[model samples]
Target: MPHSNSKCWDFCAPVAGILFALAFAPFDYSFFALLALAFLFACWQDISAKRAAMRGYLFGLGSFGSGVSWVYISMHDFGGAGALGSSLLTGLFAGFLALFPALAGYLSVKITPINNGALRFILMPVVWILVEYLRGYWVLNGFPWFQIAYSQLETPLAGYIPVCGVYGTGFIAALSASIAVEIFQIAARCDISLLSHYSYRTSLREVHRDGPLKNLPPLIMLLAVLWGAGDLLRNTAWTYPIGEPIRAAMIQGNIAQDQKWRPENKINTLLKYKRMTEQYWDSNVIIWPETAIPAYLDQVNDTFLVPLGNDAKQHKTDLIVSVPVHDADPDKKYNAAITIGKEEGMYRKIHLLPFGEYLPLQPLSGFVLDMVNIKLGNFTPGVINQPLLKAGGYPFVTLICYEDAFGELSAQGLPDAAYLVNVTNDGWFGDSIEPYQHMQMARMRAIETGRFLLRSTNTGMTGIVSPNGEIIAQAPLFQETALTGTIIPMGGMTPYARWGDRPVIGGAVILLLGLIGYRRFFRMAY
Candidate 1:
């Protein structure tokens, strides 16, 4: 039937996935990711396309299962789904996410040169990145948690972000891991005769004692050169300060999810935020977390918003707060951030969380809203293009919660928007690593855009990230506090903001074409 050892490799897939997840925030063992990727490459090498696809599927299950485990906490603990139901649903979601990787693995293996070592190595990285890009670009409610480049944020590879975006940085990372596998294959004295079944699968791309092994030293040196280049470019400034820095404050409410939206707790929530906002009136600007107000803007406009706006104007400060805005239909209700006082503007969220905010399938929207017993469940997505929100005389691109994760999407206001403001409610995730991971993603966006990113969150990670992705100041998780800091508005744009992910995808396409051309023309001539 099947080779006995093949069964063992199947289990290794999940372990490899776990190692990859361990590379990101909360774990911070980035070296483990290389090992994990190498293990996956090793496992797939020489295996049949079907077998490799199966292994890849298992790898994805492990990768997303551990990396996004916080999803379970959100669904059951906060959304009120039963533990068993949450676990099942989370499993299904991960399963769906896994298909992207599986698609890459299957297609990579299905391609010709199934026996060519250099060709296969080249193909793997290109295909992997193509899949990652597709996963994020697809309208199927993209969940780009822990992009490979994100793990490289602190590494020299991050220097590639401004030049090529996350995908290009990820390409370098994936290539390094693949090269490592190649090195191991060469050093282990893996001659064709002495080779095991594992080596056979990988041999098409690997150097045997006399074949591709001779090329290893040069390849290694090339890798060293790439890494050295990244290190050199890592700290270079892409954007500069324009006007005077403005003092800003981020208010973290630490509101519990279950009690947050209750009609009884609505007044208390407003009072809590109001009291906190008044304390920060001395600052040039005050920011409240996403959905900081439990009620719609209309419900409190006369009594709360107008008065707060007047007080903020009188105090010479700008106040921005998140609450619901319903023009008509509950399904048309929006998750919006409105600025009050000196510079007033409203930014409704464009990227929305499916099922969490609004069900993608319109028919189920009402049923889910009724079952969830939540007023904001049927919220709608915001407009595509809106001018930057002016706060403290600086233009800020405001992102709601998960929108910051999509760097390119956040850059839509670029070259015009001077800074970034992200408001999120991480209370749904409880005191888990989700907030930290989310904040890390937000920081990367700042680095990419060459603009300061200020994040105010409900129950945690209220902080300021500098243009270079460094955290200047942060508040404790699950704390009711205000994080105040001075942020300079930047005038110029980073390469990433000016261009976007186009360069990366464009380069990938060119490389893929070259590979295809070389394989057909050069090999056929031989």
Candidate 2:
């Protein structure tokens, strides 16, 4: 049978994961993230690789199960998946994500000795972050939500965002947690006498006599210094303002998902947006939410869009709006955003949302979705390296919907694209924390690119984010409102925008390989 202490950690691991979710938006208990990871690190220490993997799996199951529970809302409330099917699918999805953390735990232990300090302090963080990068970027076309760095946006770790990006910041956060755990573990070893004596006085005396407590202060100080450095760097600006500030407005139509696409509601939707936008025509730029027009480009071009474009040009304002586009090939319709007035351009979405925009795994995904009564779009992805869309006589990157979640994709036009614009329809998730979480990730893009981000969304979280990841202005959820703000076009690039994730990911790869080589060499010498 396992020791009582080990059993206790096993019970606490899942609980810790639940607390970890609270560190993100809608709760904003940021420090809870550090405490939760430290608890997880404690559970993995001195454990067999298999046992560590199981604990990690449990933690992951709890983390994603609570963090992304909104998936059930989107599937059942909107996609028509019945309660039973949606619940099961959500569980299975969380379980699949859990495997990544399990892999991190297994690799951390397998690659280093269980008793080695490096196992807790070095290898653990490296393996954990690398696994996150893999799961966030590669698998299933990427689901980067719940990444730890997004939770640290308001913390000192945010200072590192413009320099190394989200993955690097996450690596530092995990490393900090591991180091704190190591200190606590050392203190625990020193106070082992208390377990037998049942005396608090004896434990204090023993802990001091063991001499580990003397070194504890220095380790604690070192952690403080790291945080201090981040705090100091927070004032550093990586990008500078270019031209004069322009007045911008984001129109949140707050359309009901159930009624948005109805033929009878189409004209009403267009007129509604037109009326709302007419109020902000004095602004230099006006944006409409994703698919606010409720019809294809060809359907509205002649009677509706042309007149709107003419009016925008007459007012000396640029209008950006989203509506589906019909290509010459009937099967190649795209979720696209277009600019009218001042300058004209089009950008089709490059990254399609898995399941929401298109089905994955073909027959299997289609079969399961059909059985669940879930229906989704069959949209096509646009070509890469497309030209930046121009608005108000300046170039900007266009990210339709969740494209802002992918930092690298958002940075592709950077150092050239003056700013970032994201148009999203968040009505599918309906009053859930998903919109808040989405807004959080989108703000990180502004930090990464060192540019103002204009986000227009349907049914909530339409806002403006400044270069340092601060929310400049935000509309209330499920409200029909227009958020107006000013954006200064930024002219330079942050290190993150210039190099992307290469430096941090490369360092991790090299460090892991070096550790493996060192271990093999010592084993052969012995």
Candidate 3:
């Protein structure tokens, strides 16, 4: 049977979800995440586990449906999927992501009901963050988008990134939300008690006599400490700059997605990039966006890259550019980044975008995608332990497209990698917030590794991020321009770069186990 207030929670849940999406980039109302989570946590209270899960699913729908709506643009506008097909796939993708939060709500209630105040507060936040961690790394080759911690890059909670990475920061944020709801429940005791299965009228009357502010001071203090400590930590430098700043330039070609891969437009595209590069010959290092050369590496290696390399060497400047590599085996092609002039090296992308780079589940996914008239690449994955490529005489890690979203992957190149370079072509999702959201995630990587992040993207958001996650410089969206910035290569690793996500995830696992043990002991004791 549905509870009396189920309708209210059902309505509020999705609204809260929309607010949650607003807390992230482009909208960037950071505190809205806290409010949204608090509302959702409050909704979970006094509801059946099933009802909670349903409301959570609805919240997920609202959040991802709005947050990642740009997926439809990429599929329909660029990938040739019609509007109906694109909408269906986008909705399906959002629906699938919603299951993560549904699992969180269900497990949270089943583990510890809301009536047990102290236990519920701790267990619920732990369960929520563990589920978030799972959704980020374990599911679907890892889509770490819209993780609550990403929204906190501008907040003091960003201080937690260098210490414990995204999951840990997210855990703190979830804990803050849960605690806020508990504080409200304490203040408005009767309202929550009336909604629940139990009648606490007499108990509330006694508590009312004592006043509602009895238990709030400790929680308020704790909240202050968490945020205050984060602010203090923000000033702590985890990595130190080691050498003279290198003058780097990033070229944004603003190539139209539809015309980018056309055979006839290849010459024009090459000429445009060459013309842009010729102007920055004095820069210590110059970068081009992903697959700047629309054709295969072999097709233009002799006629184009060789002459460009010779010119770059003559000018004593290093060039870093991305192109598709056609290996001897046709099936072994890669989306690779190559360094020329002062050094010659290549780093093939290790983490391939599922469906975008290659279809998983082989013939099954291929057939389904074909039915929707959506075409995807069939690129090969590179080895994980590939050597770092050098630019401007400094060894740096390179990420192609969305790979920077995986913070631990950026850390893997650490201590050794002096700075970071990410080449992206966000042109597929035209005139949308996807590029901005992507840039936000990339900034989080710079914080985690304490290294300058040089992101060269086609069409929009070509920029440089400092070690502290601030944008040093940015090129305007949809512009044919070059972003010039100074990058000081840092020589130390942030705690996150050294330890990765193990401590945070391991702590969550231990807390969950402890909760299970406490539940069993409580049952036995009673």
Candidate 4:
């Protein structure tokens, strides 16, 4: 049994340590790479399930608490909430985010054969990955923000993204951590009895038959294969060139969230977008950020619509603009994008941001509403099978604001959309890296679907990404500007687009079930 101070430290240290690591969560220098190592160190002392869970939860709380602290900025700065309210809300969100890692830790210990060091090491990666995957899409509409795979955007490992999505990169990262831990355990063994008791069967044989160097070959080869394959895939041209290039213009009107809803600022916002659009009128297609029009579609009189529609038709161009729509359904409102041109239509956003768009806890929502200064409460979800809009003979799916962050949601609605058009108001988060992170998530979606992703954000990170997750063109942050580029919409699907995360989750379930069954029925011992 551990002492009180030791127990307290054990309980709290992992969380604090993880939080510290996440303080450097930008994509700069592989910060998460080091954080993963630290996590292994924190878990090294105790190999039990309970300890693992506690540590994992702490780690998760720290990682998410720090990395996503930007949420507090939005709530406090823009959500019309006071400091205390924002802090409380932030804590609640972070706590909820921490649950995924808690699950990972608990399940890893339960499934792993701790005494068999090799098996424990092998299974830890699988357990970690499965848990992360679950967090990405399971409970409460799934929040996959700040996934470890996001940090690998600039790394060679990113090549695997087109084939397996970000989740697979996470698996590889976790596996690398496991290997490092295994080495640490092996080095720390002091006695033959301890070695015999804790070492893996393979390790024991390797020690006795061959030297320590014998196992090194497999480890080196495994890493070499992962890195080598990733490099090879990175250089490979997985996407075929389209016969013709589609010229598009992305307008980044730097609208402030505070002034967005005010009646006085409405005209200013409209003019800003219109002026930017005029510059790009020659492009094949022009796009505006999310909720570019502050007023509902019905509320915007023909004065605004007629001229914009005429301009699009006269320019021989299609305009994809985001606007709030209030249909005949008096009770609901939708965030939607309408394409105005020869083939005019609309695509409503299916997945809405939980707290930002729709509050989950209705009773508590009222309390939050009273506390916060924001006027609106809920935005309705669109139908599951919403089709891609056709404009200028190009088929494309439109994702509003944070909707592009979700890999499955982006892929499911339109499998055959020539490409993706993501419209967002990242101005809510200001000049933070939140916009960059959001764009990174959008790139993953492009890779998953093997399509060109054209993201237009109000406060920069507006860019065009290729099918394999490379940024072809990007505007500087916090700049009110417009970028005109030619995007080749790729046809056909990557493995991730065809199946999505189901295969990964299904594989995990099978492995876990098979392990449970073998343990229960056959009484297999490691």
User: In terms of lDDT, which candidate is strongest?
Assistant: 3
Candidate 4 runs further than 4 Å off = 1-25, 34-38, 41-45, 187-214, 372-376, 413-415, 518-526
Candidate 4, residue 481: Cα displacement in angstroms equals: 1.1
Candidate 4 lowest-lDDT run of ten: 19-28
Which ten-residue region of model 3 has the weakest summed lDDT? 190-199
| Candidate 2 local lDDT, 321-433, one digit each (tens) | 89999999998999999999877889999999999889889989999999999989999999999999988667999999989999999999988989999999889888788
lDDT of each: 0.83, 0.88, 0.90, 0.73
TM-score per candidate = 0.91, 0.94, 0.95, 0.89
lDDT pick, better of 1 and 2: 2
Off by over 4 Å in 3: 1-5, 190-213
The superposed Cα distance between candidate 3 and the true structure at residue 135, in angstroms, equals 1.5
Candidates ranked by TM-score: 3, 2, 1, 4
Q: Cα RMSD to native, each candidate?
A: 4.7, 3.4, 3.7, 4.1
User: In angstroms, how far off is 315's CA in candidate 3?
Assistant: 0.8
Off by over 4 Å in 2: 1-5, 192-218
**Backbone clashes in model 1, listed as residue pairs:** 45-201, 45-202, 46-201, 46-202, 115-204, 116-204, 117-204, 117-205
Estimate the overall C-alpha local distance difference test score of candidate 3.
Answer: 0.90
Q: What is the lDDT of residue 511 in candidate 1?
A: 84
Candidate 2 TM-score versus the reference: 0.94
Name the lDDT of candidate 4. Answer: 0.73
lDDT of 4 by residue, 69-106 (tens): 78888887887788988888789888888777777777
TM-score of 3: 0.95
